[model samples]
Each structure stands twice: as structure tokens, then as C-alpha cells.
Target: MAHPVDVHVGQKLKQIRTLRRHSQTDIAQRLGLSFQQIQKYEIGSNRIAASRLFELAQIFDVSPAYFFEGVNGANDSEVTPCNTSTTISKALAAIEDETVKTRIVTFIEDISGMAVGRQG
Candidate 1:
């Protein structure tokens, strides 16, 4: 069975990669590995080395610790979707109609009272 820490890290990896809109092949090419290897890493079937993790951090423009965030408190029940902000950002980006996009943003801002803070 995959270790919890490994699963968490893999989840983080997939989340960030999806947020950046990079295909598995893109990352695989940059790392000089096969897409299958990337898939394995994303599924927690293979553990990432510390050195490779550092490389991934560089590619994603985040700190190495980013992959480990929320690990301590995470449980199977907490294994939900990617970060809400990331999902919202992706959805907003996909809207081709400016008017619809604006309305969606306005709705969110209105309901949120324009509050700015880290999401839980």
C-alpha cells in the first residue's frame, strides 16, 4: 500500500501540475523521463527522490515544503479535490465569454464580501 505521506505528496504534485496547465508529457520531457514515470509519481506508486522534488519545486516556482503542506493533519476523509482556489481559478480561466466571467467573479466577491485570506 502507498504510504500516506507519499500519497499526500503525489496529490500535491498533481494539483500544482494541473493548476499550471502542464500535461504529464510536458513535465516528463523537462525531467528527461517517460510520461509513465510521471503518472506513477502522480499516483504515489513511485516515491520521488528529494533531489527530484527540489527540481519539481523549481519548475513549479514553489518552495519544496509546498508538497508537504497539510500532511500532518490529512486523513483519508480529508482527501478531497484540489485546492478550491486552484479549481476556481481554472474554472474562471476556462470561461470564454467575458460577460459570464465577470458575472461569476462579481457573484463570488459579493458573497465572500471581498474577504481575503487563506482558505481552510
Candidate 2:
């Protein structure tokens, strides 16, 4: 089975690639990989080497850590081993319509307010 962290990184990689309007073929060509290989990397079916990951980060113009942005257990101080960032990132990535994105943002804001109210 693929590791959860690897899966999360793969999801993030796909999300960033989509957000940047880069196609699998385009990215693969740049990396000198087959599109199928890119797909595997995006789907977490294959483990990306550290060196290749660095190369990907360059292609995306981000640090290698960017691929692990939503991954949990990155820090020792964070309470609850939850993939909060990953969840949010995935949710946002699924919203293709701008109007839907606006509504989702509003909903999140309202939910955040409710949580704060409960705390207060």
C-alpha cells in the first residue's frame, strides 16, 4: 500500500499542476518522463525520488516542501494528527467554477465564525 504521506504529496502535486494550467504531458516532457509516469506520480502509485522531486519543485517554481504542504505530521508541535491543510487544499482544488469558490469561501468563513463563537 502506498504511504499516506506519499498519497497526500501526490494529491498536492496534481492540484498545483492543475492550478498552474500545466498538463501531465507538458510536465512529463519537461522532466524527460513519460506521461504515464507523471500520472503515477500524481496518483501516488509510485514514489518520487528526492532528486526528481527537487526537479519537479523547480518546474513548479516552488520549494520541494510545496508538494507536502497539506501533509500532516510535518511538525512536532501541531496538535492532532489531522491533514487539515490537505483537506482544505483538496476541497478547493475540486472547485473549478469561480462562483463556487466564492461560495465555498463564504461557507468556510461562516463555519470558522461558529467555531470561534463556541470557543468564546
Candidate 3:
């Protein structure tokens, strides 16, 4: 069985790769590996070494810590490429200006008719 941490890391890899529009073959060529090897890394069938993880971080222009962003958060096992919440969170995180982020949040709330800061 794959370790949870490994799976989470792999999921992150796949997510960022997709967001950056990079194919498995692209990443594999950059790293001088086969696409199948990239596939295994993205599926958690094989664990990534620290050096390779650093290389990936460089390629994606994100910190290595990016892979572990929500590993300790609730419902981590449900994190996947298709998760809208995860996608939104990533988009929000990419925005450096707090004012822009707040406005975007307010816009989303307005369009969705969801009250911000209200919990059921």
C-alpha cells in the first residue's frame, strides 16, 4: 500500500503539473526520465527522492513545502485534481495582494449568494 504522505505528495505533483500545462512527457524529458517513471511518481507507486523533489520545485517555481501544504488539514484523502475547493485555494494563494484577494472573495460570495464568515 502507498503511504499517505507519499500519496499526498504525488497528488500535489499531478495537480501543479496540470495547472502549469505540463505533460508527463514534458516533465520526464526535463528530468531525463521516461514518462512511465513520471507516471509512477505521480501515482505514489514510487517514492520521490529529496533531490528529485527539489528539482520539481524548481521546475514548478514553487517551494518544496508547496507539496505538503494541506497534508495536515482535514479530509486530506479527498484531495484530488478535480477538487474545486483545492483549485480555488491554489488560485487564491497565487495572488500576492491581500486587497485583491479580499475583493475576489467578496465577488465570489456575491455571485454564489453564500455569506462569508457564516458557518452552519
Question: lDDT scores for all predictions?
Answer: 0.82, 0.76, 0.83
Note the clash tally of each candidate. 0, 0, 0
Q: For model 3, state the Cα shift of residue 69 in Å.
A: 0.8
Q: After superposing candidate 2, which stretches have Cα over 4 Å from the reference?
A: 74-120
TM-score of 1: 0.67
Report the lDDT tens digits of candidate 3 across residue range 1-120. 887778778888988887676889999999999999899997888999999999999999999998877776676564434357557767876888989988898888877888756653
Question: What's model 3's overall lDDT?
Answer: 0.83
**Runs off by more than 4 Å, candidate 3:** 73-82, 85-120
lDDT of 1 at 82: 49
Candidate order, TM-score descending: 1, 3, 2
Backbone clash pairs for candidate 3 read none
The candidate scoring highest on TM-score is: 1
**Tens digit of per-residue lDDT, candidate 2, span 1-120:** 777666766777777787676889999999999999989987779989999999999988999988766445665333332346456766787788989987786777677785455332
* Tens-place lDDT digits, model 1, residues 11-118: 888888876779899999999999999999988889999999999999999999998877656464354444675677678778889899878877787788784553
| Lowest lDDT 10-residue stretch of candidate 2 | 76-85
TM-score list, all predictions: 0.67, 0.63, 0.64
lDDT of 2 at 17: 82
- In terms of lDDT, the best-performing candidate is 3
